[model samples]
Target: MRSGRLGLSLGLDLLGARICSFDCLYCEVGATDALTLAQKPYVPAKRLLGELSAFAASGPPAFDVVTLGGLGEPCLNTGMDRIITGCRETFPGLPVAVLTNSSLLSQAAVRRRLALADIVLPSMDTLVPGEFAALNRPHPDLSLSAIRQGLLDFRSEYSGRLFLETLIVGGINDTAENLDVLTDFCRELRPDRVDVVTMTRPGAYAMAQPAPPDTLARFRAALGAAATDGGVGHGPAALRSRVVDHKGPSSGPAASPHETMARVAASLGRRPQTVKQLSVALGLPEDDISRAVEALAREKKIQARAELDHVFYQG
Candidate 1:
């Protein structure tokens, strides 16, 4: 059940708890319930190893990589190095990756810890201090300068596949000026590949809207050669294919409309969730969840709330 989002990756909920430095407005995992800057052992290595062992013992893993991130920042865990090592030891030859918000990379120690990962995916939504504050809403102590320096330092030392991601919101960061600045900085950073993604999923803020297709296209064009449409893999198809090709297709039938509605309603009645979270929870695609959400909204069975540009569905 925990294995959802970004297909083909064995997503380890390393934090198993919410402990992030940034309370980003567009976080799909919901608002930062307990924010902190300290890195400590949130989940004991023994417990995490046990879970991985149990999962592997159950059957062959239907994943291409072992992703060390879930509800919160993976770097926040003091034992991240141990977890990465353990995963490698448990699943030999499986690439280990970590998706970071790039908040903790300012510290050389943090960068060294991430060196073990085959792929280090760090997000840089915006370089401007004002835009960064409004979008990422990082901890008070974190500065734009420090973050920039950290990325630069990490790029220089880290010798792995350094993939970068930028989340764009319509009015917040889709401006021509902002795109120009981002293009310049990304070129300087020299990432192996860059993903120019908008808010495809719901987030903590109402204003977190996705950039128009044309706007995204322009943004990609501006980012120059390294820019790509998809975030981790080239596109959703590319991400899904990694799993489908390895495990064959999912044998289970798609949920019926009535079943989908009932499940969606049950989750919304208890609490609001973004389409992405709903998709992950129900083991359905985002497109299916979107259609169900729209149908429910039209029937007045559920309500949608906007935070930043992302919408939360509630019943």
Candidate 2:
């Protein structure tokens, strides 16, 4: 709700050196662990450096931040130091930002390596171990106190803006007891701002519900003073940017840009469209289109209907 009065870019996401630190529980790309560490030559150093060079030489929207997000944790990417260095060389004035889970910040080497960034958005969702495990289901090695102390330690050293993110899952961690403890933790971190977010997309765990609007309102009011006199807190910035991984949206030689479809019990707001019609209209290969449709349905992005043996889709 409340935030900085200082002048800052209120407009772009693709401007400079922006990076993400952790692959999260609610990540759109699926399991944070599946991509693993340095999952391949994916996001190689030289390649990203080149993109940074081109963005800097052009200026502004050419790039502004080197956000370390996408499918996995950016800190885990062994080449992170190199990536930050290249970004710095390419655009010395550009600020670097990292969006992360805060779990890995406990590692000294990791913290030192991340010092290059101008802003860091680190999130801690729970204060109790059982609650933490139930929600984030993080790697076995991490614990609540360690993660909390790591954030405090990193904040003590980082010269950049630190915005701590905490998503309020409805009915899960919104209990009064949880809020009291988490608030105390935030008091200790004393970050620049505390962000509150809710689910906009479907999640892997069906029980992952967004906190209620009323609860979010209460959180904002409760945290408002902290933001005003102590610090600032607001909703999260849009979930980073589109990943450069996919080779553009799949399209054919003549037909339209292929659109993704999903399955739901009831259509949310969109009109109905049949798979056969979607296939012909979208020009996507039949099999690929089918896969896309099923995936969307799983994500609850769209609704499905069946008559006789045929199934239809609606957003």
Candidate 3:
């Protein structure tokens, strides 16, 4: 492992497979066929353990902060708390982190379960009613206010760090008024840290673009200044590596088309361009593009690294 960006956050997808509750508009894998709460196939748990044990044994501090979010919402996976706690004992004091949509965190049982981990990084994109609906387009059962209070309450109650992620979509939540609203939401919660970002991936909405580089800068400037600075924890740097056997554009479970595309994209290091771009370049439909991406991604064929507003698949 070598030094990389994302401020030294090391990530591992614990589910051994992809499963989730929301088919987010900004999902890099594209539209999900279902909102799944149950787990299914991928790499097995034993395989995950073998890989993790091997990686850690290969080098000390294989990562700084071990992240539980990737591919799909990690919280949706029931074994997350156990996995995080288990890693702490195995790795000893390795900070655990999870990035959730905060969709399910509103449930008291769910919030209580999160306590087993060290840090919870939930997203709160929309503060206003309409903005919430348009941006997050969350499950029909949830609301923006509910999302806000969830973050507040989670931080208030949880002993671990409560970090909030705000994905700043362009022409959507980048307005001055919207920023102010977002600022207030963060202020109320006083999250350990608040990061504003844009959707740089070529996800579902063609309109979903990463916030301007300037927008991210200004957002951090305005909000970072007034916020209470939290203490930093030491972690190993994030590293970049290629999936040796990326099964791009494959069919069936062994290597889905989506994982193949993602594997190729990750090897490329930058977000693959818009699916439209990939479709035109490859002469494929936009709908099927995600399948290709997800398959490749699963195989480590493509990696969706952040740019500015949009996540470009590796060409």
Candidate 4:
């Protein structure tokens, strides 16, 4: 599917389950099941590489980037280094990206593995400890200070593109003080880009609401002259602060019913979407999307929720 930040991207599910270091309130993949910091080969490197080779041989559509992220933090997988290397060997010329929750980056070993990727997207919602716990619900052993220092250390050593993301949940991390602290850290870290985003879909917690548009606007304005031009769907720019919009049309050719159902399931796993949104995103007719949604719901692969006057489906 086409990502707003990475464009046409293919995702690699290194962790097959909902295991993450943080049970984030705004997690679109639902609540975390195994919330821990222990790093091990959840999916063996050799197995993942073999799957990658097989998938590539099937003549899949062209994608701009190969992303190592699924329902959980990709960094928690101990085999990430091998997977990154394997992805490069399998799909030459395509940039490899990893989406991490910035929880395990505190470990030097994790940082070393992450350095293998061409682009690293890590999120830091709030710098305040209280806000951090309230929003992220991080593991008991994970400290905000350590995570912050780890980001600094990674910036000092890594040469790849680092796009730092901050998801501002309404009344949680959207305070002026928190934004100020986040701005200061952004200046210190000097990431290639800074994506300020809010919830656009159903979150794990019912109380998690999207930050007001004015709140996001003020935060962007606070970035001042330091804010660069690059935002969503654009190339890298220095310390660019802008809201991320993931809504975009799919790029590949028309898909059959079975293929459509697979795509729909994958999309819902990433974020909740209504029938209309699914129709526009998948480039399929509303009838096709509705049929797929109904089938998926019957199969218990996805669930529907009524919110904001529309029924949204999530996987």
The prediction achieving the highest TM-score against the true structure is 4
lDDT of 3 by residue, 179-276 (tens): 78877766677766666655544665666776778887877666554445532221111111111121112212443455435443543342246555
lDDT of 2 by residue, 271-305 (tens): 24455544433334566557766777777776687
Ranking by TM-score: 4, 1, 3, 2
State the lDDT of candidate 4 residue by residue for 13-62, as single tens digits.
88889989999998877899999888889988999899879877866445
Candidate lDDT values, in order? 0.73, 0.57, 0.58, 0.78
Best by lDDT: 4
Pick out the ten consecutive residues of candidate 2 with the lowest summed lDDT. Answer: 7-16
Give residue 32's error in model 4 in angstroms. Answer: 0.8
- Where model 1 places Cα greater than 4 Å from the true spot, the runs are 1-7, 226-315
Off by over 4 Å in 4: 1-5, 224-253, 262-271, 276-287, 295-302
Decoy 2 TM-score against native: 0.66
Candidate 2 wrong stretches, greater than 4 Å: 1-25, 33-42, 54-64, 227-235, 239-315
Ranking by lDDT: 4, 1, 3, 2
Task: List candidate 3 segments past 4 Å from native.
Answer: 1-7, 15-18, 36-51, 54-59, 230-315
Task: Give the C-alpha miss distance for residue 9 in model 3, angstroms.
Answer: 3.7
* Local accuracy of candidate 1 as per-residue lDDT tens digits, 1-315: 112334566667667766788888777667787778888888877899888887778666666677777567888887888889999988898888888989998988889899888888788888877888888888898988898889989988988877777778878878777887888878778877776777655667767777788888887677745343223335322232232211212325677787677778875664467887677555667787788899999999999876535677888
Q: Count clashing residue pairs per candidate.
A: 13, 23, 52, 0
